[model samples]
Target: MSRVVSRGLSAASGMLGGALAGAIFKQVWKLASGKEEAPQATSEEYGWREVLVAAAVQGAIFGMVKAAIDRSAAQSIHRATGK
Candidate 1:
């Protein structure tokens, strides 16, 4: 595969991974908190602990998803090009 094609696939995979992560986080948050909406970090209604926890969880999920997608994309490119 060409470099352009590989880059395109990587970009597409990253976007899809981000979307998947967001959906997963939303569902997990709902299940864990029993609330449909997650607490905002800047909102006064939520305590600092709750806000920090939500931020941490979301950040972790996003990082993991991005890493996984990036690694998968690189492997796919390597396999296709043998380089």
Candidate 2:
């Protein structure tokens, strides 16, 4: 039962983390690049360096946010159910 609860919580948190990560990445990119949007891979204006840098930054933020959210959820589940 606790496992099922944790799975559900994890799923929900994953979605939230993705959204939070996207927002954070957008703000960071704006500050770093002075641009409102990150370059798409197909965008001709941005070279490989810009695109790769954006990708790396976005991935790092998403990974960190997911880890933090997952850890928080796990802690909450343990506190609630002693699991």
Those runs of model 2 whose alpha carbons end farther than 4 Å from true positions after fitting are 1-3
Candidate 1 wrong stretches, greater than 4 Å = none
Q: Clashing residue pairs in candidate 2, if any? A: none
- Please state the error at residue 73 of candidate 1 in Å: 0.8
Q: Which ten residues in a row have the lowest lDDT in candidate 2?
A: 2-11
lDDT, model 2: 0.91
TM-scores, all models, native as reference: 0.88, 0.90
Q: What lDDT score belongs to each candidate, Candidate 1 first?
A: 0.87, 0.91
Count of backbone clashes for each model? Answer: 0, 0
**Cand. 1 Cα-lDDT:** 0.87
lDDT per residue as tens, model 2, 41-62 = 9999999999999999999999
Cα RMSD of all models vs. native, in order, equals 1.6, 1.3
Specify the highest-lDDT model's number.
2
